[model samples]
Structure formats: C-alpha cells, structure tokens
Target: MSGVEFNRRLESIPVYPAAESYGEDEGLIKLASNETPWGPPPAVIGAIQGQLETLNRYPDPAKSVLRRRIAERSDVPISKVVVGNGSCEILLAAGDALLEPGAEIVYAWPSFSMYPHLAAQSGARAVEVPLANGVHDLEAMAREVNAATRLVLVCNPNNPTATAVGIDEIDAFVASLPRHVAVILDEAYVEFNLLQDPGESIDLLSKHSNLVVLRTFSKVYGLCGLRAGYALGTEEFRLAVDRVRQP
Candidate 1:
C-alpha cells in the first residue's frame, strides 16, 4: 500500500457498524435500520420517474425548490432551512462548523451511535451522560455542560429505546443551556412518537436562536434511499452549516 496519512483524529473513531443485509428471498422485514414498513406512495414513485429524463444533469446546488418546500411545510423562512444528503450530514456539518480540538459535545450515552463518532471526527471531547433507565437523562446531560461545551445533541424518541421527553422538558432544557452552546434536536423518529406533539419543536426555534432542529424523509416518508434531510435554525446557523457542507 502507498504510504498515505489519514487524519489522526480518525484513529480514535470506531467504524460505524452498518446493519446486515438480506436477499429478497430471505423474506425479512429489516427493522434494525428504523426504515418504514412500507415503501413510498405511488405519487412519490411517479415523481421520481418524472425526473428520470434529467439523470445526466446535476441537481440544483442551492436546493432551491426543495428548501422552499421544506420551509413552507415547517412554516419557517427559507433562509432558516439547510437541506443535506441526510439528517446525519447536517449533524456532521454542525460539528464541522462548531467544533474544534478543544471543544466538547455533550449527549446521552446509549443514544444514536453517530453521536460519539461526531465528537471523534471533529476532534472534540465527547461528554456522554449515562441514561437514566433507558431514557436520556436530560438533567444529567445539562449538568455536564461547561465553558468548553460547544454542542449538545438530543435524540428525541431516542433510537433503540423508543422513549421520548416531553416538549416542556425540551423547552426547559434549551432554556437552561448557555447562549454559546448549540443544541441539535434530532427529530429523526418524531413521526413515530405519538406521545408528543410533532409541531411543538418547530415553535421552539423562534424562542431559541442557538437551537437547530433536524428532520429527515428517511424515517416517516420512506425515503431513506433518497437521503433527503433538512435543518431549521436561525439564518446565521444555516449559513455556517452550508459553508461546510459538500457542494
């Protein structure tokens, strides 16, 4: 092998363990990836077919049409929306923009596997608070924050555990954080959560300028293969994430 040097930071990051795949004949319903039980509706399939003619052309780098649609749906200004290949990409972009070697990122232990990787890739310290009975101990997570903390990731209706904190709990948590700390409220499984109001978090954006809400089509919309996701935040935050995102 040619002697090539990789980023030393990558040395500490464990490879993300992807789920196992099965052949069509295996008759398996793979729930491990959190994919929908059914595929997208006919309308969605038709929309994809309509775009087949444009296969040779590149998609709009600005993602103008898609961003406008997401903005209209979320009832937020287009400037506040940043679309990515997936919600995971937005998470990485946030780390790239807000984290450095000395910064710290706080999140609960046994949460999304991606959390620890984010900290490692950014060369930021990972402050993992132990879960209180399989649920994110938000209080414990908040207590871990200090001057060096730059980002806090909260995965509501948390993966692997299906448990969620109420909106009031989230509101109070964000309110408690310092203005310098950016909170990434990952709502990947929000649609599956019947306990909390889905739209309540969108309202929190206007109240906290440092909060960035992430949503994805992969979960509820059955668009995991398409990799469409977006973030809702203040214009400043949107621009910062966009700057670091791939063109």
Candidate 2:
C-alpha cells in the first residue's frame, strides 16, 4: 500500500501557517491552534536532562513508565494500555488491524480528519455522521451500524468543536451497540474536560468489552511532538490492536 494514491482529499485540506513562524515581535494571540505555549514542567525537563546520556540507547518499546502512570491514573489495567507513536498511530493502528476493503468505519463528520484518512488508507468505507450542534448524536450513529461495521468512532469533547457527551449518555450509547461491533472512543482532548470527571470513561470500559478508549500525551501533557499515546481496553482487544502494530 506504499504506492497507494492519496487522491484529491489531501489536496483539498487547507495549508494554514504555523504559529511558531509568527514573528517574535508580533505578540500574536494564536488561538487558531490550541497548543500550550508552556510545555513540560521544570522537574520533567530536569529528568529528561538526566536521561540525555542514555538517549543513544533504545527506549522501552512497551513505554513502561508512561504506561504505568496512565494505568494508575486511568484505573484501567496495565495489560489494557497499548502505547504508540502518538494518538494518530493508535488510531491508524486500529485501522491497520481492523479495516479491510469494503469494511465500514462510522465516525462523526467535522470531528477529526484522521478518522477518515485512516479509513481510506485501509481501503475501507467511511461513514461520517453529522453532528447536532457540535455534539455527537449516538442514536444517529447507531442507525448506521450494520454487520459489516468494523468500527464505530466517537471523538468526545470533540475536536474543532470541543463539546463532550456526558458519561451516562456515552455509557448508554455503548450499551446500545451490538456486541459484534467495536466502538472506539477518541478522547484525545479529554484531559481538559471541564464539565465532568474524566475518569468516568475508564469505568465504562468494564461494561463494554468491545470499547477501546484512546488517550494521548499530546493534548494535556503537551507532548504532541514526543509521539506517545495509548489505547486502553480488554486484553483480547489490546492484542487485537497489537497484531497490526508489531513489525
């Protein structure tokens, strides 16, 4: 698939200028991107500096430090977390593992572009559900699910729109889905959720075995460049995603 054509979609995406390129003297308040100007804390920087001598050595493939921390914080088991290059890598890994030609991937439109990109890259059909006032309508999304549906994607506290579907509502949606279908919760922006406790999703995972919760170091940790994120779920599901990930 290396030689696969990208077609016109990639061409259509607008090329916005980087905020970093803005002149130092401009004093621009750039909200066009939500990146945190202040990144890792002083202690984190000091720790990284201490590890600079070992930078030449291969980093942990399992990402033990990050994974254990996330597991302790998330309340999901360690076996459930599968860390990858970034949130995109985890989603793309989901694509590589599950998507096949003619298979279906249902996602909310205008939520995240990567959902469609991964769907296309896997040569699968992409079903984009329209948002209702910037929130995902789980009922409408459920209507699109069929036997051929390989994955149903939900980007909560949705990107570009930044709205959340509450825990009760999200749980109801997961319960409503058929057991055969997999539901991926894309909670990339979840850390900064102001309306409710972010840990609610972790609790929901126990009910729906097919649910895969996605998280990232990019958004809250402010480590998007570090290319680290993880997916948490049952052992079977993590292994299901791992087969596509392992070289």
Candidate 3:
C-alpha cells in the first residue's frame, strides 16, 4: 500500500456490491443486476455500427450532437443539458460539485445505495430518511434539510424497492425546500413508470430552478453497453455539474 493517508470519509463506505459471476462449467444464471436481458434494437445497433468508421477519432468533448437530441427529447434548452458516461457519472459529478466538508445530502433510505456513497466521497453527511411503506417519505426528507444540506436525491421508482413518487408529490417537495439546496431527480426508470403525460419533469424544470432530472439510455432505450445518460436542469445547475465532469 502507498504511504499516503486515505480520506477518513471512506471508512464508512462499504465495498460496492457487484454482480456475482460463475464459471463456464457452473452455468449459473446471473440476475442480481438490473439490466435488460435482451439485445439492443436494430436502430441502436445501426447507429453504433455507423460510428465504427470514426472509432480512431475522439468524440466531440461537448457531445453536442447527443446533447441536442437529449435536450429535444427532454424539452429542455440545449444549454441545460449535460450528458455523461451514465446517469451514475452525473450523480457523482453532483456530489463533487455541490458538496463540501460537513455538508449534507438527503435521500430516501433503502433507495439507490450510491446516493450515500457519493455524498460520503465529498466529505458530506448522507442524511437517510427511512422510506414509509416502500416509498419515499418526501415530507420527512424536506424537514431534514437544514442550512448544511446542499443536495437532495430523489430516485423516482426507487431502486431495490421498486416504488415511485408521483409528479404532484415531487412538486410539493421542491416547493417546500429552501431555494439554496439543489435536488436531483434520478429518473433512471421513468420510461417504465410514466404517468398519463411523460414530460412532467421537463415541464416542472421551468418552475423549479434548483432541480436536475437525470435519465439513462441503459433502461428502456436498451443501450447499457453504450453507457449513455444525461441530466437536464437550469443552466446554472447544469454548468456547475459539467465543470466537475471529465471532458
């Protein structure tokens, strides 16, 4: 081991529980991870194959083409879109950019495990509000937000539990929060749980300045191997997160 000291915050972080593997002879089926078992659609395959000719060239650092498409799809301005290797990268970027020593981030307990891990890496406190009956207790979470709280993560259709909070509930929660705090709506599974209207988050962005909605192509779009995802928010939030992202 190196002589350099490690960050104290890492002490509480558990090793990430990765999917288990099996030997060829064992032939064990792997189902622990949340992944699409099927192959990518023909269009996605075609688009990827189309990029093979330019494999030697580096992609546009700005990712303008993909960002433009995500902007249009999310109904957000191009300036407010920031793409990433995956939504997880966007989440990690938020932690790096928004949190500071002694800062706190609030999110539902038993939700995505990464929320707390990201907060810890930033030397921030992970304020976990226990879920009420397998759903986010948004009211409790809002109450936990004090001056030290810098960020909140809401995983709609929360992971592990497979429950979601609706648009109306989200609207009230944002309105109740202090304007200084930023909230990230991790809609990694939104496509599977859309309501009567699918653009609610996009529409809500116009009203909530501190909100960031993250989406990933790994889910319904079936592009897990491509590692594409994006975040849509106000120009201020997007730019701040982008500054921490790897170019």
Shift in Å, residue 46, candidate 1: 0.6
Q: What stretches of model 3 exceed 4 Å from their correct place?
A: 1-4, 20-26, 194-196
* Per-residue lDDT of model 3, residues 190-235, tens digit only: 8777552558877888899998889899988778888998889888
| Candidates sorted by TM-score, best first | 1, 3, 2
Model 3 weakest 10-residue run by lDDT: 17-26
Per-residue lDDT of 122-191 in model 2, one digit per residue for the tens?
A: 7788899999988898899999999899999998889889888888888899898888788889888997
Residue 160, candidate 1: Cα error in Å is 1.5
lDDT of 3 at 34: 79
Q: For candidate 2, list the clashing residue pairs, or say none.
A: 85-227
Q: Model 3 clash pairs?
A: none
Local distance difference test, candidate 1:
0.90
Please report the TM-score between candidate 2 and the true structure.
Answer: 0.87
Runs of candidate 1 exceeding 4 Å displacement: 18-29
